[model samples]
Target: MAHKRDKTPRLGVGGELWITADGRNLGSHARMGLLRAVVEQGSITQAAKAFGISYKAAWDAVDTMNRVAGEPLVERRPGGRGGGSTRLTERGQRLLERYAQVEAVHERFVEMLAREAFDLEQDFSLLKVLNVRTTARNQFLGTVSALRAGAVNDEIELTLPGGMRLVAIVTRGSTEALGLHTRAPVVAMVQAGNVILATGIESMRFSARNQLPGTVLTLTPGSVNTEVLLEVDGGGRLVAVVTQASAEALALAPGLRVTALIKASDVLLAVTV
Candidate 1:
Protein backbone atom coordinates (compact mmCIF):
# COMPACT_ATOMS: atom_id res chain seq x y z
CA MET A 1 0.00 0.00 0.00
CA ALA A 2 1.26 3.52 -0.85
CA HIS A 3 1.81 5.90 2.05
CA LYS A 4 1.21 9.66 2.11
CA ARG A 5 4.30 11.89 1.91
CA ASP A 6 5.29 14.00 4.89
CA LYS A 7 4.26 17.64 4.67
CA THR A 8 6.61 19.05 7.27
CA PRO A 9 8.33 21.67 5.15
CA ARG A 10 5.46 23.25 3.26
CA LEU A 11 7.13 25.97 1.23
CA GLY A 12 5.65 29.38 0.51
CA VAL A 13 6.63 32.17 -1.88
CA GLY A 14 5.54 35.06 0.28
CA GLY A 15 7.99 36.98 2.44
CA GLU A 16 8.90 40.55 3.33
CA LEU A 17 11.96 42.02 1.71
CA TRP A 18 13.72 45.14 2.92
CA ILE A 19 16.70 47.29 2.11
CA THR A 20 19.10 48.72 4.64
CA ALA A 21 21.66 51.46 4.38
CA ASP A 22 24.43 51.80 6.94
CA GLY A 23 22.65 49.17 9.03
CA ARG A 24 19.47 51.22 9.06
CA ASN A 25 16.32 49.92 7.39
CA LEU A 26 15.68 52.31 4.54
CA GLY A 27 12.92 50.74 2.51
CA SER A 28 10.36 47.96 2.54
CA HIS A 29 7.12 47.14 0.83
CA ALA A 30 5.07 48.62 3.62
CA ARG A 31 7.06 51.85 3.61
CA MET A 32 7.04 52.08 -0.18
CA GLY A 33 3.31 51.43 -0.22
CA LEU A 34 2.84 54.25 2.25
CA LEU A 35 4.77 56.55 -0.05
CA ARG A 36 2.65 55.49 -2.98
CA ALA A 37 -0.50 56.02 -0.97
CA VAL A 38 0.62 59.52 -0.06
CA VAL A 39 1.33 60.31 -3.69
CA GLU A 40 -2.15 59.10 -4.61
CA GLN A 41 -4.01 60.69 -1.69
CA GLY A 42 -1.91 63.89 -1.60
CA SER A 43 -2.04 63.98 2.19
CA ILE A 44 -0.17 62.09 4.89
CA THR A 45 -3.30 61.77 6.97
CA GLN A 46 -5.21 60.22 4.12
CA ALA A 47 -2.32 57.92 3.28
CA ALA A 48 -2.05 56.76 6.89
CA LYS A 49 -5.75 56.12 6.94
CA ALA A 50 -5.55 54.12 3.75
CA PHE A 51 -2.59 52.14 5.08
CA GLY A 52 -4.49 51.47 8.35
CA ILE A 53 -1.64 52.91 10.40
CA SER A 54 -1.49 55.90 12.67
CA TYR A 55 -0.41 59.28 11.33
CA LYS A 56 2.52 59.49 13.75
CA ALA A 57 3.82 56.09 12.74
CA ALA A 58 3.72 56.95 9.07
CA TRP A 59 5.42 60.28 9.71
CA ASP A 60 8.10 58.68 11.86
CA ALA A 61 8.80 56.02 9.27
CA VAL A 62 9.18 58.66 6.58
CA ASP A 63 11.44 60.74 8.82
CA THR A 64 13.66 57.76 9.56
CA MET A 65 13.85 56.75 5.93
CA ASN A 66 14.76 60.27 4.95
CA ARG A 67 17.44 60.63 7.60
CA VAL A 68 18.94 57.21 7.10
CA ALA A 69 18.87 57.39 3.35
CA GLY A 70 20.45 60.88 3.44
CA GLU A 71 17.88 61.81 0.84
CA PRO A 72 14.34 62.92 1.30
CA LEU A 73 12.01 60.35 -0.15
CA VAL A 74 8.89 62.50 0.34
CA GLU A 75 8.41 66.25 0.23
CA ARG A 76 5.70 68.56 1.36
CA ARG A 77 4.52 71.14 -1.17
CA PRO A 78 2.88 74.33 -0.05
CA GLY A 79 -0.57 74.90 -1.50
CA GLY A 80 -2.67 78.05 -2.10
CA ARG A 81 -5.52 77.40 0.33
CA GLY A 82 -4.37 74.36 2.35
CA GLY A 83 -1.15 74.10 4.28
CA GLY A 84 0.71 71.49 2.24
CA SER A 85 0.42 68.23 0.40
CA THR A 86 2.69 65.19 0.48
CA ARG A 87 4.37 63.98 -2.67
CA LEU A 88 7.17 61.61 -3.56
CA THR A 89 10.51 63.08 -4.55
CA GLU A 90 12.20 62.06 -7.78
CA ARG A 91 14.54 59.81 -5.86
CA GLY A 92 11.57 58.28 -4.13
CA GLN A 93 9.96 57.35 -7.42
CA ARG A 94 13.23 55.80 -8.58
CA LEU A 95 13.49 53.91 -5.31
CA LEU A 96 9.98 52.54 -5.72
CA GLU A 97 10.76 51.43 -9.28
CA ARG A 98 13.96 49.74 -8.17
CA TYR A 99 12.19 47.99 -5.33
CA ALA A 100 9.52 46.76 -7.72
CA GLN A 101 12.15 45.34 -10.02
CA VAL A 102 13.91 43.55 -7.18
CA GLU A 103 10.64 42.19 -5.81
CA ALA A 104 9.68 40.84 -9.23
CA VAL A 105 13.01 39.06 -9.56
CA HIS A 106 12.72 37.69 -6.04
CA GLU A 107 9.21 36.39 -6.71
CA ARG A 108 10.36 34.75 -9.94
CA PHE A 109 13.26 33.11 -8.14
CA VAL A 110 10.98 31.70 -5.48
CA GLU A 111 8.51 30.48 -8.09
CA MET A 112 11.30 28.72 -9.97
CA LEU A 113 12.50 27.11 -6.76
CA ALA A 114 9.00 25.93 -5.98
CA ARG A 115 8.57 24.42 -9.43
CA GLU A 116 11.85 22.51 -9.16
CA ALA A 117 10.47 20.56 -6.19
CA PHE A 118 13.75 21.06 -4.33
CA ASP A 119 14.42 19.29 -1.04
CA LEU A 120 12.16 21.60 0.93
CA GLU A 121 13.38 20.59 4.35
CA GLN A 122 17.05 20.74 3.47
CA ASP A 123 16.69 24.04 1.63
CA PHE A 124 14.77 25.58 4.51
CA SER A 125 17.37 24.37 6.98
CA LEU A 126 20.16 25.90 4.92
CA LEU A 127 18.28 29.16 4.55
CA LYS A 128 17.64 29.27 8.29
CA VAL A 129 21.35 28.82 8.93
CA LEU A 130 22.17 31.65 6.53
CA ASN A 131 19.60 34.05 8.00
CA VAL A 132 21.65 35.32 10.94
CA ARG A 133 19.99 38.63 11.69
CA THR A 134 20.76 40.32 15.01
CA THR A 135 20.09 43.71 16.51
CA ALA A 136 23.63 44.03 17.79
CA ARG A 137 25.44 46.67 15.74
CA ASN A 138 28.89 45.34 16.44
CA GLN A 139 29.74 41.87 15.16
CA PHE A 140 33.20 40.39 14.93
CA LEU A 141 34.43 37.10 13.58
CA GLY A 142 37.15 35.80 15.84
CA THR A 143 38.78 32.74 17.30
CA VAL A 144 38.61 31.75 20.94
CA SER A 145 42.04 32.50 22.30
CA ALA A 146 41.43 31.25 25.80
CA LEU A 147 38.60 29.78 27.84
CA ARG A 148 38.31 29.33 31.57
CA ALA A 149 35.49 27.05 32.55
CA GLY A 150 33.81 27.34 35.93
CA ALA A 151 30.85 25.76 37.61
CA VAL A 152 28.42 28.46 36.52
CA ASN A 153 29.69 30.84 33.84
CA ASP A 154 32.71 30.39 31.62
CA GLU A 155 35.08 33.17 30.61
CA ILE A 156 36.15 33.25 26.99
CA GLU A 157 38.76 35.44 25.33
CA LEU A 158 38.28 35.91 21.62
CA THR A 159 40.96 37.17 19.28
CA LEU A 160 39.45 39.32 16.56
CA PRO A 161 40.77 40.74 13.36
CA GLY A 162 43.25 43.62 13.56
CA GLY A 163 44.85 42.22 16.71
CA MET A 164 41.85 43.02 18.86
CA ARG A 165 40.69 40.76 21.64
CA LEU A 166 37.14 40.56 22.95
CA VAL A 167 35.99 38.87 26.13
CA ALA A 168 32.67 37.12 26.60
CA ILE A 169 31.10 35.50 29.64
CA VAL A 170 28.70 32.63 29.04
CA THR A 171 27.26 29.77 30.97
CA ARG A 172 29.23 26.57 31.11
CA GLY A 173 26.30 24.79 29.49
CA SER A 174 26.41 27.26 26.60
CA THR A 175 30.12 26.80 26.31
CA GLU A 176 29.66 23.08 25.82
CA ALA A 177 26.55 23.50 23.70
CA LEU A 178 28.28 25.76 21.18
CA GLY A 179 31.40 23.63 21.39
CA LEU A 180 33.33 26.72 22.40
CA HIS A 181 36.99 25.95 23.03
CA THR A 182 40.38 27.50 22.61
CA ARG A 183 41.02 28.31 18.96
CA ALA A 184 37.38 27.72 18.07
CA PRO A 185 36.13 30.19 15.48
CA VAL A 186 33.17 32.21 16.79
CA VAL A 187 31.35 35.48 16.36
CA ALA A 188 31.09 38.14 19.06
CA MET A 189 28.15 40.53 19.08
CA VAL A 190 27.81 43.69 21.16
CA GLN A 191 25.03 46.21 21.03
CA ALA A 192 26.03 49.80 20.35
CA GLY A 193 24.30 50.93 23.50
CA ASN A 194 26.33 48.44 25.51
CA VAL A 195 29.55 50.11 24.45
CA ILE A 196 30.49 53.15 26.51
CA LEU A 197 32.72 55.84 25.10
CA ALA A 198 35.30 57.62 27.19
CA THR A 199 37.49 60.45 26.10
CA GLY A 200 40.47 62.00 27.96
CA ILE A 201 39.88 59.58 30.83
CA GLU A 202 42.18 56.87 29.60
CA SER A 203 44.33 57.26 32.72
CA MET A 204 41.48 56.07 34.90
CA ARG A 205 40.98 52.38 34.33
CA PHE A 206 37.42 51.18 34.33
CA SER A 207 35.92 47.98 35.69
CA ALA A 208 34.82 46.95 32.22
CA ARG A 209 36.78 43.94 30.97
CA ASN A 210 37.12 45.18 27.38
CA GLN A 211 38.50 48.62 26.56
CA LEU A 212 39.79 49.48 23.15
CA PRO A 213 41.19 52.88 22.34
CA GLY A 214 40.36 54.24 18.92
CA THR A 215 39.93 57.39 16.85
CA VAL A 216 36.52 58.73 16.21
CA LEU A 217 35.62 58.42 12.57
CA THR A 218 32.13 59.90 12.32
CA LEU A 219 29.35 61.12 14.57
CA THR A 220 25.76 60.86 13.43
CA PRO A 221 23.45 62.67 15.80
CA GLY A 222 19.84 61.70 16.05
CA SER A 223 17.08 63.36 17.98
CA VAL A 224 17.55 61.41 21.19
CA ASN A 225 20.94 59.80 20.72
CA THR A 226 24.07 60.01 18.65
CA GLU A 227 25.92 57.15 17.00
CA VAL A 228 29.69 57.48 17.11
CA LEU A 229 31.80 55.38 14.78
CA LEU A 230 35.33 54.68 15.89
CA GLU A 231 38.24 53.10 14.10
CA VAL A 232 40.26 50.87 16.40
CA ASP A 233 44.05 50.87 16.43
CA GLY A 234 44.69 47.54 14.73
CA GLY A 235 41.86 47.42 12.21
CA GLY A 236 38.25 47.35 13.24
CA ARG A 237 35.31 49.66 13.55
CA LEU A 238 33.30 50.04 16.75
CA VAL A 239 29.94 51.74 17.14
CA ALA A 240 28.81 53.39 20.34
CA VAL A 241 25.60 55.19 21.11
CA VAL A 242 25.40 58.02 23.58
CA THR A 243 22.74 60.52 24.44
CA GLN A 244 22.97 63.94 22.84
CA ALA A 245 23.72 65.41 26.22
CA SER A 246 26.47 62.90 26.90
CA ALA A 247 27.90 63.36 23.43
CA GLU A 248 28.12 67.06 24.06
CA ALA A 249 29.57 66.52 27.54
CA LEU A 250 32.24 64.19 26.19
CA ALA A 251 32.87 66.55 23.28
CA LEU A 252 32.68 63.69 20.80
CA ALA A 253 33.98 64.78 17.43
CA PRO A 254 35.74 63.33 14.45
CA GLY A 255 39.49 62.62 14.86
CA LEU A 256 39.16 62.70 18.66
CA ARG A 257 40.64 59.75 20.53
CA VAL A 258 38.20 57.72 22.58
CA THR A 259 38.08 54.41 24.39
CA ALA A 260 35.27 51.92 23.95
CA LEU A 261 34.28 50.11 27.13
CA ILE A 262 32.27 46.91 27.20
CA LYS A 263 31.65 44.42 29.95
CA ALA A 264 32.42 40.79 29.29
CA SER A 265 28.90 39.83 30.20
CA ASP A 266 27.53 42.21 27.62
CA VAL A 267 29.23 40.38 24.77
CA LEU A 268 27.17 37.66 23.11
CA LEU A 269 28.67 34.64 21.44
CA ALA A 270 27.48 32.70 18.42
CA VAL A 271 28.77 29.95 16.16
CA THR A 272 27.87 29.17 12.57
CA VAL A 273 27.81 25.47 13.15
Candidate 2:
Protein backbone atom coordinates (compact mmCIF):
# COMPACT_ATOMS: atom_id res chain seq x y z
CA MET A 1 0.00 0.00 0.00
CA ALA A 2 1.06 3.60 -0.62
CA HIS A 3 1.89 5.83 2.32
CA LYS A 4 0.40 9.21 3.15
CA ARG A 5 2.10 12.47 2.21
CA ASP A 6 3.30 15.43 4.26
CA LYS A 7 2.24 19.08 4.12
CA THR A 8 4.14 21.82 2.32
CA PRO A 9 5.10 25.04 4.08
CA ARG A 10 3.24 28.11 2.85
CA LEU A 11 3.22 31.67 4.09
CA GLY A 12 0.17 32.61 6.15
CA VAL A 13 -1.42 36.02 6.61
CA GLY A 14 -4.42 37.79 8.24
CA GLY A 15 -3.24 37.79 11.85
CA GLU A 16 -3.33 40.70 14.28
CA LEU A 17 0.01 42.29 15.13
CA TRP A 18 0.92 43.18 18.72
CA ILE A 19 3.00 46.29 19.10
CA THR A 20 3.85 48.73 21.87
CA ALA A 21 1.82 51.91 22.06
CA ASP A 22 4.94 53.88 21.27
CA GLY A 23 5.25 51.79 18.09
CA ARG A 24 8.17 49.60 19.19
CA ASN A 25 7.76 45.83 18.69
CA LEU A 26 8.48 43.27 21.43
CA GLY A 27 9.55 40.25 19.28
CA SER A 28 7.88 37.79 16.89
CA HIS A 29 5.52 34.83 17.53
CA ALA A 30 7.50 32.69 19.99
CA ARG A 31 9.17 35.60 21.67
CA MET A 32 5.81 37.15 22.28
CA GLY A 33 4.74 33.90 23.90
CA LEU A 34 7.88 33.92 26.00
CA LEU A 35 7.09 37.44 27.14
CA ARG A 36 3.63 36.31 28.08
CA ALA A 37 5.06 33.29 29.82
CA VAL A 38 7.44 35.39 31.84
CA VAL A 39 4.40 37.21 33.09
CA GLU A 40 2.38 34.08 33.69
CA GLN A 41 5.17 31.87 34.97
CA GLY A 42 7.07 34.53 36.93
CA SER A 43 10.57 33.64 35.74
CA ILE A 44 12.54 33.78 32.50
CA THR A 45 13.93 30.31 33.20
CA GLN A 46 10.44 28.83 33.43
CA ALA A 47 9.24 30.63 30.34
CA ALA A 48 12.21 29.51 28.27
CA LYS A 49 11.82 25.81 28.99
CA ALA A 50 8.04 26.00 28.73
CA PHE A 51 8.55 27.23 25.21
CA GLY A 52 11.34 24.72 24.54
CA ILE A 53 14.01 27.42 24.61
CA SER A 54 17.04 28.17 26.76
CA TYR A 55 17.00 30.57 29.71
CA LYS A 56 19.78 32.78 28.42
CA ALA A 57 18.20 33.12 25.01
CA ALA A 58 14.87 34.10 26.53
CA TRP A 59 16.44 36.87 28.60
CA ASP A 60 18.62 37.90 25.69
CA ALA A 61 15.52 38.31 23.62
CA VAL A 62 14.02 40.35 26.42
CA ASP A 63 17.13 42.49 26.69
CA THR A 64 17.27 43.26 22.98
CA MET A 65 13.55 43.95 23.14
CA ASN A 66 14.06 46.38 25.98
CA ARG A 67 16.76 48.13 24.01
CA VAL A 68 14.63 48.36 20.90
CA ALA A 69 11.53 49.67 22.67
CA GLY A 70 13.34 52.19 24.84
CA GLU A 71 11.28 50.65 27.63
CA PRO A 72 11.52 47.46 29.65
CA LEU A 73 8.71 45.16 28.66
CA VAL A 74 9.70 42.80 31.51
CA GLU A 75 11.07 43.89 34.86
CA ARG A 76 12.83 41.67 37.41
CA ARG A 77 13.27 42.27 41.14
CA PRO A 78 16.72 40.57 40.97
CA GLY A 79 17.17 39.15 44.55
CA GLY A 80 14.81 36.36 45.50
CA ARG A 81 16.30 33.00 46.37
CA GLY A 82 13.63 31.15 44.39
CA GLY A 83 13.91 34.07 41.97
CA GLY A 84 11.51 36.90 41.40
CA SER A 85 8.59 36.52 39.08
CA THR A 86 8.49 38.24 35.68
CA ARG A 87 5.57 40.37 34.72
CA LEU A 88 4.62 42.32 31.62
CA THR A 89 4.20 45.97 32.24
CA GLU A 90 0.96 47.59 31.22
CA ARG A 91 2.46 47.93 27.78
CA GLY A 92 3.02 44.17 27.31
CA GLN A 93 -0.54 43.19 28.16
CA ARG A 94 -2.02 45.74 25.80
CA LEU A 95 0.23 44.52 23.05
CA LEU A 96 -1.04 40.94 23.39
CA GLU A 97 -4.69 41.93 23.15
CA ARG A 98 -4.16 43.76 19.89
CA TYR A 99 -2.06 40.92 18.48
CA ALA A 100 -4.82 38.39 19.09
CA GLN A 101 -7.31 40.44 17.14
CA VAL A 102 -5.00 40.70 14.16
CA GLU A 103 -3.98 37.05 14.47
CA ALA A 104 -7.55 35.80 14.01
CA VAL A 105 -7.91 37.66 10.74
CA HIS A 106 -4.43 36.84 9.49
CA GLU A 107 -4.79 33.10 10.14
CA ARG A 108 -8.03 32.94 8.16
CA PHE A 109 -6.44 34.68 5.23
CA VAL A 110 -3.51 32.28 5.21
CA GLU A 111 -5.84 29.30 5.45
CA MET A 112 -7.61 30.48 2.32
CA LEU A 113 -4.31 30.83 0.51
CA ALA A 114 -3.19 27.38 1.57
CA ARG A 115 -6.13 25.79 -0.19
CA GLU A 116 -5.04 27.20 -3.55
CA ALA A 117 -1.27 27.32 -3.13
CA PHE A 118 -0.71 23.67 -3.92
CA ASP A 119 -1.18 20.20 -2.53
CA LEU A 120 -0.51 20.25 1.21
CA GLU A 121 1.35 16.99 0.70
CA GLN A 122 3.83 18.58 -1.67
CA ASP A 123 7.37 18.51 -0.26
CA PHE A 124 8.51 22.00 0.60
CA SER A 125 11.22 23.17 3.02
CA LEU A 126 11.67 26.08 5.44
CA LEU A 127 14.76 27.20 7.36
CA LYS A 128 16.27 29.98 9.59
CA VAL A 129 19.97 30.80 10.17
CA LEU A 130 22.12 33.29 12.14
CA ASN A 131 24.64 35.73 10.64
CA VAL A 132 26.35 38.99 11.51
CA ARG A 133 28.41 41.49 9.50
CA THR A 134 30.37 44.56 10.48
CA THR A 135 33.56 45.29 8.48
CA ALA A 136 32.78 42.10 6.60
CA ARG A 137 31.64 38.52 7.30
CA ASN A 138 35.37 37.74 7.24
CA GLN A 139 36.27 39.30 10.60
CA PHE A 140 34.41 37.64 13.48
CA LEU A 141 35.39 35.66 16.61
CA GLY A 142 34.39 31.99 16.77
CA THR A 143 35.07 29.03 19.09
CA VAL A 144 36.84 25.82 18.13
CA SER A 145 34.93 23.21 20.09
CA ALA A 146 35.30 20.69 17.25
CA LEU A 147 37.17 20.63 13.93
CA ARG A 148 37.48 18.29 10.98
CA ALA A 149 39.88 18.89 8.12
CA GLY A 150 38.58 18.37 4.61
CA ALA A 151 40.63 18.43 1.41
CA VAL A 152 39.33 21.83 0.31
CA ASN A 153 38.16 23.30 3.62
CA ASP A 154 38.11 22.54 7.32
CA GLU A 155 34.78 22.23 9.09
CA ILE A 156 34.89 24.33 12.27
CA GLU A 157 32.13 24.02 14.82
CA LEU A 158 31.33 26.32 17.72
CA THR A 159 28.93 26.00 20.60
CA LEU A 160 26.29 28.71 21.14
CA PRO A 161 23.46 29.09 23.63
CA GLY A 162 19.89 27.85 23.29
CA GLY A 163 21.57 24.56 22.60
CA MET A 164 22.48 26.10 19.24
CA ARG A 165 25.76 25.41 17.44
CA LEU A 166 27.45 27.07 14.48
CA VAL A 167 29.60 25.55 11.72
CA ALA A 168 32.06 27.40 9.53
CA ILE A 169 34.24 26.74 6.53
CA VAL A 170 37.72 28.22 6.69
CA THR A 171 41.27 27.65 5.50
CA ARG A 172 44.03 26.77 7.91
CA GLY A 173 45.47 30.27 7.54
CA SER A 174 42.15 31.95 8.36
CA THR A 175 41.61 29.66 11.34
CA GLU A 176 45.07 30.46 12.61
CA ALA A 177 44.61 34.20 11.99
CA LEU A 178 41.55 34.25 14.26
CA GLY A 179 43.18 31.75 16.63
CA LEU A 180 40.04 29.66 17.05
CA HIS A 181 40.18 27.66 20.28
CA THR A 182 38.03 25.57 22.60
CA ARG A 183 35.91 27.23 25.32
CA ALA A 184 36.19 30.56 23.53
CA PRO A 185 33.01 32.49 22.81
CA VAL A 186 32.43 34.16 19.46
CA VAL A 187 29.68 36.32 18.04
CA ALA A 188 27.55 35.13 15.11
CA MET A 189 25.28 37.22 12.92
CA VAL A 190 23.69 36.69 9.52
CA GLN A 191 22.65 38.92 6.66
CA ALA A 192 18.89 39.32 6.29
CA GLY A 193 18.71 38.36 2.63
CA ASN A 194 20.13 34.86 3.19
CA VAL A 195 16.96 34.12 5.15
CA ILE A 196 14.01 32.79 3.17
CA LEU A 197 10.35 32.39 4.06
CA ALA A 198 7.88 29.87 2.59
CA THR A 199 4.22 29.32 3.40
CA GLY A 200 1.82 26.31 3.15
CA ILE A 201 3.68 23.75 5.24
CA GLU A 202 2.03 22.66 8.48
CA SER A 203 5.40 22.72 10.26
CA MET A 204 8.93 23.90 9.48
CA ARG A 205 12.34 22.32 10.05
CA PHE A 206 15.75 23.63 9.07
CA SER A 207 19.31 22.22 8.83
CA ALA A 208 21.27 25.07 7.37
CA ARG A 209 24.63 26.35 8.60
CA ASN A 210 23.02 27.64 11.82
CA GLN A 211 19.39 27.88 12.81
CA LEU A 212 18.16 29.51 16.03
CA PRO A 213 14.60 28.92 17.18
CA GLY A 214 13.09 31.98 18.72
CA THR A 215 9.66 33.10 19.79
CA VAL A 216 7.79 35.93 18.07
CA LEU A 217 8.33 38.39 20.90
CA THR A 218 6.95 41.61 19.55
CA LEU A 219 6.02 43.76 16.56
CA THR A 220 6.70 47.47 16.16
CA PRO A 221 4.26 49.25 13.94
CA GLY A 222 5.00 52.31 11.86
CA SER A 223 3.13 54.18 9.23
CA VAL A 224 5.48 52.68 6.66
CA ASN A 225 7.41 50.01 8.57
CA THR A 226 6.87 46.97 10.79
CA GLU A 227 9.43 45.27 13.05
CA VAL A 228 9.34 41.59 14.01
CA LEU A 229 11.11 40.12 17.06
CA LEU A 230 12.51 36.61 17.47
CA GLU A 231 13.62 35.27 20.90
CA VAL A 232 16.23 32.60 20.07
CA ASP A 233 16.85 29.35 21.93
CA GLY A 234 20.11 30.23 23.67
CA GLY A 235 19.05 33.46 25.31
CA GLY A 236 19.40 35.56 22.17
CA ARG A 237 16.91 37.55 20.12
CA LEU A 238 16.58 38.78 16.50
CA VAL A 239 14.68 41.75 15.17
CA ALA A 240 13.58 42.34 11.57
CA VAL A 241 11.66 45.37 10.33
CA VAL A 242 10.07 45.76 6.93
CA THR A 243 7.17 47.48 5.21
CA GLN A 244 3.71 47.37 6.71
CA ALA A 245 2.41 45.74 3.57
CA SER A 246 5.08 43.06 3.80
CA ALA A 247 4.11 42.37 7.41
CA GLU A 248 0.55 41.83 6.26
CA ALA A 249 1.77 39.63 3.43
CA LEU A 250 3.75 37.43 5.84
CA ALA A 251 0.84 37.04 8.30
CA LEU A 252 3.18 37.43 11.28
CA ALA A 253 1.85 36.68 14.77
CA PRO A 254 2.79 36.42 18.46
CA GLY A 255 3.20 32.62 18.71
CA LEU A 256 4.71 31.83 15.35
CA ARG A 257 7.80 29.96 14.24
CA VAL A 258 10.61 32.52 14.03
CA THR A 259 13.89 31.43 12.43
CA ALA A 260 16.95 33.66 12.14
CA LEU A 261 19.02 33.21 8.98
CA ILE A 262 22.81 33.29 9.14
CA LYS A 263 25.06 33.74 6.14
CA ALA A 264 28.80 33.16 6.07
CA SER A 265 29.21 36.68 4.79
CA ASP A 266 26.82 38.17 7.33
CA VAL A 267 28.17 36.36 10.37
CA LEU A 268 30.48 38.33 12.62
CA LEU A 269 32.59 36.69 15.26
CA ALA A 270 33.60 38.28 18.54
CA VAL A 271 35.63 37.04 21.49
CA THR A 272 33.17 38.46 23.97
CA VAL A 273 29.44 38.31 24.48
Q: Rate the local accuracy (lDDT) of all candidates.
A: 0.86, 0.61
Cα lDDT of model 1 by residue, 100-127, tens digit: 8998877766665564435543312222
Q: Model 2 over residues 97-167: C-alpha lDDT tens digits?
A: 66767777666556655553344443211111122225321222345588777776666777754355677
Model 1: lDDT of residue 165? 90
> Lowest summed-lDDT stretch of 10 residues in model 2?
123-132
Q: What value of lDDT does candidate 2 attain over all alpha carbons?
A: 0.61
Residue 58, candidate 1: C-alpha displacement in angstroms: 65
Candidate 1: pairs in clash: none
Q: What is residue 239's positional error in candidate 1, in angstroms?
A: 0.8
